[model samples]
Target chain A: MSSVDRSQRSNSTLKTLNRVFVYTILIVSSLMMLIPFAWSVITSLKSNENVFTHSAFWLQFPPDFSAYKEIWNRIPLLKYTANTLKVAVIVTFGQLFTSSLAGFAFAKMKFPGRDKLFVIYLATMMVPGVVLLIPNFVIMRTIGAIDTHWALILSAVGSVYGTFLMRQFFLSFPSELEDAAKLDGCNPFMFYWHVLLPNAKPILTTQGLMAFQFIWNDFQWPLIVLNSESKRTLQLGLSYLMSEYYTDWTLLMAASVLTLLPIIILFFIAQKNFIQSFKLSGLKG
Target chain B: MKKNRERSPRVSLLAKNKIREALWGYLFISPNFLIVLIFTILPVFFSSYMSMTDWNILSKPNFIGLENYQHILQDEVARETFFNTFYFSVLSVPVSLILSLLFAVFLNQKIKGIAFFRTAYYIPCISASVAVSLMFMWLLANNGLINQMLTSFGLGPVKWLTDPKIALNSVIGITIWKGLGVNIVIFLAALQDIPPELVEAASIDGANRVQQFFKVTLPLLSPVIFFVTITGVINSFQSFDLVYNMTKGGPGHATTLIGYYIWKQAFDYLHMGYGAALANLVFFAIFILTIIQWILRKRWVYSEE
Candidate 1:
C-alpha cells in the first residue's frame, strides 16, 4: 500500500512534466506560424527607411501609412480588388448552383447511367489541372474570350470536388423527409427548391467559402488568360507589383497585407464552417 | 375482375411519373454536365491530340507524331525540372507528415488555449498563396529577420532564395510551413476518432506512452497518414504558384518544378504542343503514383470496418 502511494506520486509528477513539455512546443510552433503575418503587418506600417533597419519584431515609434497611400497611386488597387471580388462572387455562386444541382441529382434521383456518370466525375478529380491548361487557353482564344472574366467564371463553374462534397452531404440526409414532402404534392423542382435547399444551408455555406477562396487566390489560370492591365486579378496585380517594386519592401508588404485581409476576415467569421468542411472532406478519403 | 381493372390504370400512372422523374433528373444535371463536357472532357482529348502536334498559338497545329515526346525525353531542362519536382515532393511529403502528426499529437492533449493555437496554425492555410509567398520572400532576404537571428548567433548570413543550391530547399520550407495546418487538422480529426478505451487498455497492459503510440495509435491513424501522403505528393507535383511567385523558377533552373516548367513552355515560350506533352506526362505520373499507393495501402492501413 505504501509502495502504491509512492508510485502514484511519481506518475503524477511525470504527467505534469509531460504537460509542460507539450505546451512549450505547441506555443513555440504556433508562434512560428503566426509571426510572419505579424511581421508583414508591422513591416507594412513602417517607413521605407525603417523597414530594413528596424528589428523585425520592432515597430516604428510612429507607424506610417505612407506606403499604403503610395501603393494606391502606384497601382490600380481598387480596380484590381473590384475585379477579384467580381470573379470570386460569380465563381462561388456558379459552382454552388452547379454542384448542388448535380449533387441532388446524384443523391436523390435514379436516372439511367447516374452511377457511371458519377464515377467519371470522380475520375476527373484526379486529372491534373495543368493537363487542361493549354487546351483551355486555346479554346478560350478561339472563342474570343481570351482576355475576359468570362474565361475565369465559366471554367470554374463545374467543380467535381464541390459536387462530391454536396453529394456526401445529401447522402446523409434522411429520405423520409423527401417522402413526406412528395406526399404533400411537391414536384421534383419544388422539392429541390423548397425542401432540399433549405436543409442544405450548412453545406452550401461551406462550399461557398471554399469556392470563394479558390477563386480569390487563383493565380496561374488568371495569369494565363488576363493579358490587359485592366483585366488583371488581385493576384496577377500582386505578381506585377513584386516584379516592378522588387526593392520597395514597405509598399509590397502593404499590398500583400491588403490583399490577404478580406480572406483572413472571412476565415475568422466562418472559422467553424471552414474546419468542419475540412473534417468532412478529409474523412471522405 | 373489377379490382384488377382498377389497379391497371394506377400502375400505368406510376410508370408515367417514374419516366417524368427521370427526365427531371436529366434536366437538373444537364447544366453541369454540358459545362464539364465542353471544358473538361473536350480539353482532355484536345490536349492529348495537341501533344502530338507542333503549334505555337499563332498557326494551325502540324501533326508530328512522337517528336514532342522524344524532345521531352532528350531535353536537359525537362530532366532538371522533373528532378526538382521529385526532390521537392520527397523532402516535403514525409517531413510534412511527421511534423504535422507531431503537432496534432501535441494539440490533442487536453490543455488551455488549444483553440487559439489551432487557429494560429491554420491561418496560413487559408491565406492567398501569392501573398504568403511574397511575405516569405521578405523574411528570407539576406538581411531579413531569419538572417538577423542567424547572425546574432554568430552564424553568417545565408542567401535563402538566390543561391541555386539552397533555393529549392527554401521554397520547400515555405511550402511545408503553409501546409502544416491542413495536415494537423486532418490528423487531429483522425486522432479524435481513435477510441479512448484502446489507449487506456494499452497503458493498463504495461505499455509506456511511446510504446502505446507506436503499437496502438499509429495503426489506427494509418488511414489518415495514407491519405495525407498521397494528397501531399499530388499537391507537391502540382506546385506552381509558389514557384512562380517566389523564385519564378529561378536563380537558374533550380526551383523549376514540372508544373511551372509546363507553364513556361506553353505560355511564356509559346511551345503549346510541348507543354501539352509535358502535362500528359504529369497526369500519367500522378495516376501511377495514386495506383501504387492504393496497392500499397492494403499492407499498412488498419481496416476498421
Candidate 2:
C-alpha cells in the first residue's frame, strides 16, 4: 500500500510536469500563428514612419486611420465588398437549394441507378478544380459571361462536397417522420418542405456558413473570370491593392484587415458549428 | 391461390408508387445534375479533347493529336514547375501531418486555457488566403518582424521571399502554419474516437505511457493518420493562391508549382491547349496517387473490427 501511494505521487508529479511542457509548446505555437495577424493590425494602425522605424510589436503613440481612409478613397472598397456579398450570398443559397434537393434524393429516395449516380457525383470531388479551370473559362467566354458575376455564381452553384455532406446528414435521419408524413397523404415534396427541411436547420446553417466562407475567400476562379474594376470581389480588390501599392505595407495591411473582418466575424458568430462541421467533414473523408 | 390474389393488387399499387417516386427523384436531382453536367462533366471531356488540340481560345481548336502533351514533356519550364510541385508536397505533407498530430495530442490534454489556445491556433485557418498572404508578405519582408527577431538573436536576416533557394520552403512554412488548425481538429476528433479502455488495458498490462501510445493509441489512430496524409498530399499538390499571391512563381520560376503553372499557361500566355494538357497530367497524377493510397490503405490502416 505504501509503495502504491509513492508510485501514485510520482505519477501525478510526472503528469503535472508533462502538462506544463505541453502547455508551453501550445502557447508558443499559438503565439507564432497569431502574431502575424496581430502585427498586421498593429502595422495598419501605425504611421508610415513608425511602421518602418519601430518594431512590429511596438505600439504607435498615435494610431493612424489614414491607411484605411486611403484604401477606401483609392479603391471602391464598399462596392467590391458588395460584389463579394452578392456572389457569396447567391452561391450559398444556390448550393443549399441544389445540394439539399439532390441530397434528399440520394439519401431517402429510391430510384433505379441511384447508387450509381451518387458514386459518380462522389468521384467528381476527386477531380481537382484546376483541371476544370481552363475548360470552364473557355465555356464561359464562349457564352460571353466573362468579367461577370454570373460566371462565379453559375460555376460554383453545384457542389459535390456539399451534396455529399447533406446526404450523409439525411441518411442518418430517422425514417419514421417520413413514413408518418406519407401516411397522412403528404407527397414527397410536401414532406421535404414541411418536415425534412425544418428538421435540417442545423445542417442548413452549417452548409450556408461554409458556402459563404468558401465563396467569399475564393480568389483564383473569380480572378480569372471577373476583370472589370467595378466587378472586383473583396479578394480580387485586395490583390489589386497588393500589386498597385506593393510597397505601401500600411495600406496593404489595412486592406488585409478589412478583407478578413467578415470571415472573422462569421467565425466568431458560428464558432461551434464551424469547428463541428470541419470535424465532421474531416472524419467523413 | 387466395394469398397470391391478396398480394397481387398491393404489388401493383406499390409498383405505381415506386414509379412516381423515381420520377420525383429525377425531378429533385435535375438542378444539380444539369449544373454539374454543364460545368463539371462536360468541361472534363472538353478539356481532355482540348489537350489534344492547338486552340488559342481565338481560332477554332485545330486537332493536333498529342502535340501539346509532347510539348509539355519537352518544355523545361513545365519540367521545373512539376519538380517544384513535387518538392513542395513531399516536404510539406509529412511535416504538416506530424506537427498537426503533435498539436492534437498535446491539445487533447485536460488543461486550463486549452480552449483559448485552440481558438488562437484556428484563427489563421479562418482568415482568407489573400489576407494571410499579405500578412506573411509583411512579416517576411527583409526588415520585417521575423527578420527583426532573427537579428536580435544574432542571426542574419533571411530574405524570405526574394531568395529563390528558400522561397518555396518559406511558402511551405506559411502554408503549413495556416493549415495546422484543421488537421489538428481532425486529429483531436480521431483521438477522441479512440476508446479509453484500450489505453487503460495497456497500462494495466504494465505498459508505460510511451508504450501505451505506441501499442494502443497509435494503432487506433492509423486510419486518421492515413486520411490526413492522403488529403494533405492532394491539397499540397494543388497549392496555387498562396504561391500566386506571394511570389507569382517568381525569382526565376523557383516557386512555380503545377497549379500556378497551369494557370499562367492558360490565362497569362493563352496557350489554352497546352494548359489543358498540363491540367490533364495533374489530374492523372492526383488520380494515380489517390488510387495507390487507397490500395495501400488496406495494408497499414488499422481495421476497426
Candidate 3:
C-alpha cells in the first residue's frame, strides 16, 4: 500500500514538472515571437538618437512623433495607404460578388458541363503566378492597364479558390431553404439574392477578410504593375525606404506599424472567424 | 378525369422552369469563369508560347524553339537558386510543421487567458510579409541588433547576411517566424476538432501522453499535415518577397530564389522569353509534385478517400 502511495505521489510530481516546463517554453517562445513586432513599434516611437543605440532594445516612453510627422514629405505614405485601402476594399467586395454567384450556381443548380468546367478551373490553380507574370504583363500593357490600378483590381476581382470555397459552403446548406424559395415562385436571381446570400454571411465575411488581407499585403504584382509614385501601393512604396540618399529606419518601422494596424484591428475584431477560415482551408485536404 | 387532364400542362411548365434554372446557372457562372479564363487559363497557354521564343522588351519575340529551355540546362544561377529553394523547403517546412504541431499539442490544454495567448501567437502572420521581411532585414544585418547583442555578450558575431549559407538560413528562420503563428492557429483549430474522448480512450488503454500522441493523435492529424505540407511547398517555390526584401539575392547569387531569378530575368535583364521558360519549369514541377502528393494522399491521410 505504501509503495503504491509513493508511486502515485511521484507521478503527481512528474505531472507538475511537465506543467512547469510547458508554461515556461510557451512564455519564452511567445515573447520571442512578439519581440520583432514589439521592437518595430518601439523603434518607430524612438527619436533618431535612441534608435541608433547599441543596445538591442532601447526603451523610450512618452514617444516623440517627429518621425511620424516628418514621414509624410519623406514618402508618399498617405497616398500609398489610400491606394492599398482602395484596392483591398474593392477586391474584397468584388470577389464576394463574383465568387458567390458562381458558388450558388455550382452548388444549387445543374447546368451543362458544370463538373468538367470546375475541374478545368481547379487544374489552373496549380499554375504558379510567376508563370503568368510575363504574359500578364504583355496582356496588361496591351489592354492599357500597365500603370493603372485596374491591373491589380480586375485580375484579383475573382479567384478560383474563392469560388471553390464558397461552393463548398453553399453545398452544405439545407435543400429546404432553396425548395421553399422555389415554392414561393422566386426566380433564380431573386432566390440567390434573398435566400442564399443571407445565409452566407459567415463565408462571405471569411472570403472578404481573406481577399482584403491578401490584397493589402501583396507586393509583387503591384511592384510589377505600378510605376509612378502616385500609383504605388503601401508595400511598393515602403520598398524604397532604403533609398540611395539615406535609410531611415524610423520611417520604415513607423510605416510598417501603419500598414499592420488595420490587419491587427481586424484580427482583434474577428479573430475567431480568421482562425475558423484557416481551419476551413486546412480541411480542404 | 379533369385533374388528370390538368397534369400535362403542369409537367410542361415545370420542364420549362428547369430550362430557365439552367440558363440562370450559366449566366451566374459566366463572369467568374470569364475572369479566370482570361487571366489564369489563357495566360498559362500564352506562357507556353512565350517560352518558345527569344525576345527582349524592345523587339518582337523571335520564335526559337526550345532554345530558352536549353539555356536553363546550363544556367548556373538557375541551378543554384533551385537548390537554394529546395533546401529552404526541406529545412523550413518540416520545422514549421513540427513546431506548430508541438505548440498545438501543448496549448490544447485548458488554461485561462489561452484565448489571448492564441491571439498573440497569431499576430505575426497577418502583418504584411514585405513589412515583416523588411523589419527582419534590419534586425539580421551584419551590424544589426542581433549581432550587436552577440558581441555585447562576448559571443562571436555571426555574419547573418554576408555569408551565403547563413544568409539563406537567416531568411529561413525569419520566414518560419512569420508563418509559424499561422500554422499554429490552424493546428490548434484542428486539434480542438479531434474528439477528446479518443485521447481519453487511448489513455484508458494504458497509453501515456506521448504514446497516445503518436498512436492516436498523429493519424487523425495526418490530413491537416498533408495540407500544410502541400501549401508549404507551393509557397516555398514562390519565395521571393523575403529574398527580395531582405537580401535581394545577394552575396554572389546565394539567396536568389526561383521567383526572384525569374523576375530579375524578365524585368531587369529584359529576357522575357527566358523568364517565361523558367516559369514554365516551375509550373510543370509544381504540377507534378501536386500529382504525386495527390496519389500518395490516400495512403496516409486518414478520413480521405
Candidate 4:
C-alpha cells in the first residue's frame, strides 16, 4: 500500500512538471511567432531614431505615426490597395463560382464521361504551376494580356484545389434535397439555386476567405505579371519598399502591418468556419 | 420550325426523365471544362514545343531539337540550382516533420490556454509571406534585433544574410517557422484520429506513457506521417516566395532553389526554353520521389483494419 501511494505521488508530481514544461515551450514558441508582428507594429509606431536605440519591447515617450505618413505619401499605397482589392475580389468570386459549379457537377451529376473528365482535371493539377508558366504567359501574351490584371486573374480562375475541396463538401450532402426541389416542379438551375447553393454557404464563405488570403498574399505571380508602377499589387509595392534599402525601418514595418490587417481581420471573422473547412479538406487529402 | 419544336419537345419529355439532372450537369461543368482545357492542357503542349526552341519574349520560337535539354545538363548554374534546391528540401522536410509532430503532441494535451497557444503559433502562417519576409529581414540582420539580443548575452554577432555558409540554412529556418503551424494542425488532427482504446490497452499491459506512445500511437499515426512527409518534401522542393522575397537568391545565390532559378531564367533573362527544361527536370524529380513513396508504403505503413 505504501509503495502504491508513493508511486501515485511521484506520478502526479511528474505530471505537474510535464505540464509546466509543455506550457513553457508552447509559450516561448508562440511568443517567437508573435514577436515579429509585434515588433513590426511597435517599430512602425516608433520614431526612426528610437527604433534601433529602444529596447525591442519598450516604447519611449509618445508613439509616432510619422512613418505611416511617409509610407503613404511616398508610395501610391491607396491606389495599389485598390488595385489589389480589384484583382483579389474578382479572382475569389470567379474561383468560387466556377469551382463550386464544377464541383457540384462532379459530385452529384451523372453525365457521360463524368469520372473520366474529372480524372483529367485532377491530372492537370499534378503538374506544377512552374512548368505551365512559359506556356501560360505565351498564351496570355498572344491574346494581348501582358502587363494587365487579366494576366494575373485569368489563370487562377479555375483552381484545382478549390474544386477538390468543394467536391468533398458536396459529396457528403444528401440527395434528398435535390429530389424535393424537383418534386416542386423546380428546374435544375432552380434546384441548385433554391436548395444546393443555400446549403453550401458556409463552405463557400470559407473558400472565399481562403481565396482572398491566397490572392492577397501572393507575390511571385504578381511580380512576374505586373511591371507598371500603376498596375503593381501590394506585394510588389512592399518589395519595392524593401529593395530601396532604407534605414527607415519604421516605414517599412508600417507598410507590412497595414498589409497584414485585412487578412487578419478575415481570419478572425471566419475563424470557426475556416478551421472546419480546413479539417474537411485535410481529411480528403 | 418543326425541327426546333422537336428539340423543344425534348425539354418537355426530358423533364419527366431526369433531364433536369442532365441540364444542370452540363451547365455547371461546361465552363470549367472549357477553361481547364484552354489553360492547363493546351499550355502544356505549347510549352513542350516552346522548350525545344529559343524563344525570347520578343520573337517567335523556332524548334532546335533538344538543344535546351542538352544545355541544361551542362549548364553550371542549372546544376548548382538543382543541387541547392535538393539540399534545402532534404534538410527542411525531415526537420519540419519531426518538429511539427512534436509540437502537435504537446498541443494535444488537455492543458490550459491551449486555444491561445494554437492561435499564436498559427499567426505566422496566416501572415503574408511578404510581411513575414520583411520581419525576418529586420530580425536576422547583423545588427538587427536577433544580433542585439545575442550581444547582450555576451555572444558574437553572426552574419545571417551576408554569410554564404549560413545564408541557406537561415532560409531553411525561416521556411520551417513559416510552415510549422499548418503541419502541426495536420498532425494534431492525425493524432486525435488514433483510438484511445489502443493507448489504454497498452497502458493496462504495464506500459508507461512513453511506451504506449511508441508502441500503439506511433504505428497508428504512420500513415498520416507518411502523407505529411511526402507533401512537405514536395512543397519544400517548390519553395519560392520566401527565397524570392527574403534573399532574391542572393548573397551570391546561396539560397537559390530550382523554382527561383526557373523564375529568373524565364522571366528575368527571358530564357523561356532553358527555363522550361529546368522546370521539366524539377517535375521529373518530384514525380520520381512520389512514385518511390507509393512503392515503399507497402512495406512501411500500416492501415487501420
- Candidate 3 per-residue C-alpha lDDT over A1-285 given as tens digits, one digit per residue, 9 for 90 to 100: 999999999999999999888888788888878888887777778787766763656677788777788778778788888999999999999999999999888888987898998888778777778788899998998899988999999888878888988888888899998889888998889988988888899989988898898999898999898999899998888777654313467777787788788899998999877887676666453
Tally clashes: model 3: 0
Per-residue alpha-carbon lDDT of candidate 4 for residues B201-291, written as tens digits (9 for 90 to 100): 8899999988988888888778778777777777766788888888889778788888899899999999998888777777777777666
- iRMS for all predictions? 1.6, 1.5, 1.7, 2.2
Candidate 4 segments whose C-alpha is farther than 4 A from its true place: A52-58, A280-285, B1-20, B292-305
How is the predicted docking of candidate 3 categorized under the CAPRI scheme?
Answer: medium
Q: Let me know the DockQ for model 3.
A: 0.69
lDDT per residue as tens, model 1, A210-237: 8898899999999999999999999999
The clash count for each model shown is: 0, 0, 0, 0
Q: Local distance difference test, per candidate?
A: 0.90, 0.89, 0.84, 0.82
* Candidate 3 Cα outliers beyond 4 Å, as residue runs: A244-246, A283-285, B1-11, B299-305
User: What's chain A's TM-score in each predicted model?
Assistant: 0.95, 0.94, 0.95, 0.94
Over the stretch A1-285, how does candidate 2's per-residue lDDT look in tens digits? 999999999989998899888988988999998899889998999887777787756888678898988888889999999999999999999999999999999999999999999989987877888899999998899899999999999988988888888898899999998899999999999998899899999989998988899999999999999978999999999998899988799999999999998888888889988897677667444
Q: Candidate 1's residue-wise lDDT over B160-242, tens digit each?
A: 99999999999999999998999998899889889999999999999999999999999888877888988898888789999
Model 4 Cα lDDT, one tens digit per residue, A6-41: 999999999999988898898898898788888788
Enumerate the candidates' DockQ scores in order. Answer: 0.71, 0.72, 0.69, 0.62
TM-score of each: 0.96, 0.96, 0.95, 0.94
In model 2, the Cα lDDT at residue A156 comes to 83
lDDT of 1: 0.90
lDDT of 2 by residue, B1-305 (tens): 99999999999999999999999999999898889989998899999999999888778889999999999879999999988988988898899999999989888878788888888878888788999999999999987988989998999999999899999999999999999999999889888878889889999999998998888988878877888888887787678899989999988999999989999999998899999999999889888877776677777765432
